[model samples]
Target: MALPFARVVFLCRWGAKRWGIATAEARRGITFKLEEKTAHNSLALFRDDTGVKYGLVGLEPTKLAVNAERFLEWAVVLADTAVTSGRHYWEVTVQRSQQFRIGVADVDVSRDSCIGADDRSWVFTYAQRKWHTMSANEKAPIEGIGQPEKVGPLLEYEAHRLSLVDVSRLALVHTLQTDFRGPVVPAFALWDGELLTHLGLEVPEGL
Candidate 1:
């Protein structure tokens, strides 16, 4: 059934107001659709003292498996490759959880602090029911119209920017412009109460 017209209008206004993006032109930059359709099989589990599980299932990309309830214990994982330049994009399907994170990080980033807690990573995260883009010590608030079953991260290296989008809704959640330097890799992190959490990579038709 179609949504009530009033509810649809409310949602549109909510999305734009969710993040204090500051400028209309900046907002436009994030709504651009990606031209590629292939999902890269490049994720790998990045283990640390956080006690998170990561591994590869046959014919599947690396998956981060979490079953604990410790709110401070974060599941940190990374893609198998690093990029120093050019634009890069990928999608991840998240199993339900209280919080989730997606973005890129320097290989040497600190696992002790949450992703984007320091200079090593730039991340889009959900915590305490709020959405944000994080870099260094700054947390950029995002509107998070809804929890997306699928999320895509787009990085423009030369531009030193990162954008988060709801793949299912085809809407931009937020973008972060920063001084993030090169040699970074894709990373994911999440934490929650006693609930099963899984971060899955979406694979394309081609290997």
Candidate 2:
């Protein structure tokens, strides 16, 4: 028989707490890599010769010529792997990129839209010197954290939590809580410059 609404809520809360406690002490490793086939502008996605980094080097001349009047210019890329269970963590280095969004997206997220434009995605965005946490077309300014050169995103899938961390200061910048519908992949949107993904890492302690 179907349970009552109150019991359902109680079970969810208990499950979340149990999952959090289970992952608190262990160091979980996640594999990460951008998938070229999943990019909105695959032509603009490039990997270094060493195969250790990824970048969006702007649009090609042919593409620009065809859509010169209105080209969004933002390229969104998803990782080759998806996280369906457990807690996964990874970091992204934003050194030369001035405008970008980094976070996680559901497998079926719309390719035409940038990250955080829909309910399927969550991103910590940096644009025009401002930092904001965004999802479902809503954005909230992240004040006083200063500009972080590197951002660490910790995904607790079972608990439905995505936490953004400032790697330099070891500070927890923000956390997004929601019921993730299905498998989620690492997602990135870039207007210009490069983004380096750091994988196979352990979640840092002390939040």
Candidate 3:
């Protein structure tokens, strides 16, 4: 069951100004200045009673889910903390679900759709020994890194930079530089079958 979004985020690009669309940064050529905004700095689920199982166990992942009877087919969960400014990094241990997505999404992205399958999200996933990145309807192959045991995401909100690090090898796997606007939260999805618990939630400080 998908619930109504608590808020709606409008994405905008920046370069000579704020909220300018049309790949503003491209027109200005990769030189983007930092814009400041106040937003929550901690990460957690919107609520504990999500359609899927969620809670905290010690310091591992502050948030966790395994899915319930109703959402056994597919489900999505967003972190309570929304990043609006500054540079931040975090990691997730993809546990049970053989098919899963890890990345960020707008507050109002389609609840029924999987992350990365839509334009508002930037994510990475693995299934059947293959890895890919999702951007809207496009799924592109990402080589040199496959099925990372732990994924480290480095987000520079003001700079509009997103990098997915292969924590297993301490190497950079994928990177995206965009001016995505809105209250973005860490997004997760599980598919293929029921996923068991074991994913960690604690935000890793850095490499």
Candidate 4:
């Protein structure tokens, strides 16, 4: 059975912008493009327009039916999670009500760490952790902000894995295309290589 709620968190190293500032029309465009590219149904993509994007799938009713406890757990975590970044590292930690946590840690491993004998090596890491807790009743608002019209649920089980990468890539490519003045094709792409490596996905060999 599909999990009631699944989220693909995009860990960006450089940009920190509000994802919700993206207009509804822009979200619709992204959704259409996503539908064109993949077999699974599309979900609307909302951007704060500053940097971050929140794309939610699956309806609250269906989510509750699928797994009320897990759905609530994710909702609480999504709302309360913290994002922190510095000169050499960036991290986001989501603490679920159930005590489970998911964290994405990205470090600039290429930087020299020999400044001091006590200096610690910085390496990128992504980890998904789970925990269990007794059930309790709780109520929260569920506004259908970035939900596609066609897809029954806000999210698809299998597609969640790819959506984060796809959305981030689309955002990056779209930005690049807009900035270029003349005909330009992708020459090379730079991303958080460590994140991809941690996910066990191979970076595309070429553009």
Candidates' C-alpha lDDT: 0.49, 0.65, 0.50, 0.17
RMSD to true structure for each model, in Å: 17.1, 12.1, 11.5, 20.7
Tens digit of per-residue lDDT, candidate 1, span 1-207: 011111111111112222222122231222211101111112222222112232222112223222121112234554434555555555656555557677877644553455777887998887777788887868878885566566777677778888886777656667788576546666666443211212222222221
lDDT of 4 by residue, 44-134 (tens): 1122211112124433443232321111212111111112311011112121211111111112111111101111111111112221111
Please give the TM-score that candidate 3 achieves against the real structure: 0.58
Q: Which candidate achieves the best lDDT against the true structure?
A: 2
Clashes of each: 1, 0, 3, 13
Cα TM-score of candidate 4: 0.15
Stretches of model 2 off by over 4 angstroms after superposition: 1-28, 42-74
The residue-by-residue lDDT of candidate 3 on 118-203, one tens digit each, is 78888777776777877785887778876556677766677777788877776677787655776565566654332222222232
Q: Sort the candidates on lDDT, descending order.
A: 2, 3, 1, 4
Q: Which has the higher lDDT value, candidate number 1 or candidate number 2?
A: 2
Task: Return the lDDT, model 3, position 47.
Answer: 23
Ordered by TM-score, highest first, the candidates read 2, 3, 1, 4
Worst 10 residues of 2 by lDDT: 1-10
Whole-model lDDT, model 2: 0.65
